[model samples]
Target: MTKIADFRAMTPDQLSDELLKLKKEQFNLRFQAATGQLEKTHRVGEVRKDIARLQTLLRTKQPAA
Candidate 1:
């Protein structure tokens, strides 16, 4: 699992890619949970937090108009 600090240091494109991957994983986790196949339910919270962290970093890095 990647650290939030490391993610914050990434370029926008890298952060974007990571965000997309995290979203996909979140979807899978939800599906697994619905079917009672989730091995680690805690991972869902971590992924959601990571996505939020990435988004926050992206917003902070954006140049103001």
Candidate 2:
């Protein structure tokens, strides 16, 4: 559950790192689902949205840099 303001406060490098971390979590969540080991199913959607947010923010920031 990340806020847009929190993402906006981060530097581009920090945002990239956060995006990578979210992607890893997304992978793990997918694996868990495949194995039927996932409990909090809603987290997958959350991570996906967070990753998208980071990507969008990065793109918006890039044009200004």
Candidate 3:
């Protein structure tokens, strides 16, 4: 998992790709939880937080037209 500061340095396209990857991971985590296969439930929260952090960084880095 990448840090928020490192995420902030990424370009918008890169950030979007990262967000997509994180979302996919989150979905898998949810599935694992439903199947009782999740060994690390805390990872779900971490992925959610990372998603939010990436979004915030994307918004903050957007240039004013």
Write down the lDDT of every candidate, Cα atoms only.
0.90, 0.98, 0.91
Candidate 3 differs from the real structure by a C-alpha RMSD in angstroms, to one decimal, of: 1.3
Clashes of each: 0, 0, 0
Better of 1 and 3 by TM-score: 1
lDDT of 3 by residue, 1-65 (tens): 56767987789999999999999999999999999999998899999999999988888878976
| Per-residue accuracy of model 1 over 36-56 as CA lDDT, tens digit each | 999998899999898889999
**After best superposition, candidate 2 residue 35: deviation in angstroms?**
0.2
- Candidate 2 off by > 4 Å: none
The best candidate by lDDT is: 2
TM-score of 2: 0.96
| 2 or 3, greater by TM-score | 2
> With candidate 3 superimposed using the best TM-score fit, by how many Å does residue 27's alpha carbon deviate from the native?
0.2
Relative to the unseen true structure, what is the C-alpha lDDT of residue 11 in candidate 3, on a scale of 0 to 100? Answer: 94
- Identify the runs in model 3 with alpha carbons over 4 angstroms from their true place: none
- TM-scores for candidates 1 onward, in order: 0.92, 0.96, 0.89
